[model samples]
Target: MDVNGRVWLIEANPKPGRTLFIKTGERKVYRTSVRRPLQYAMF
Candidate 1:
């Protein structure tokens, strides 16, 4: 998701029920979410 001037990639695993996150700036041109809550929303 794109927020402010940055983006975030969220990954979700169904089998293990876990989530992962990565900053879009750190990702490649097109390297790509889970249902986990986003903390940035508070900001």
Candidate 2:
């Protein structure tokens, strides 16, 4: 996100082809699902 300034991203699921967690946190909101690919991140 150069336009929006420096933004860092992380990979939620380190394992490939496998989902370890999904929809983490209720307030901040975090998602990681093997079923879904387009939307998922690891902190």
TM-score of each: 0.18, 0.18
Q: Where's the lowest-lDDT run of ten residues in candidate 1? A: 27-36
Please give, for residues 1-43, the per-residue lDDT of candidate 2 as tens digits: 3677876665555654333233233322223333246643242
Residue-level lDDT tens digits of model 1 in 1-43: 4667776758644653232224334333223223224444545
Q: Which stretches of candidate 1 lie over 4 Å from their true place?
A: 12-43
What's the residue-level lDDT of 11 in candidate 1? 63
| RMSD (Cα, Å) of model 2 | 9.3
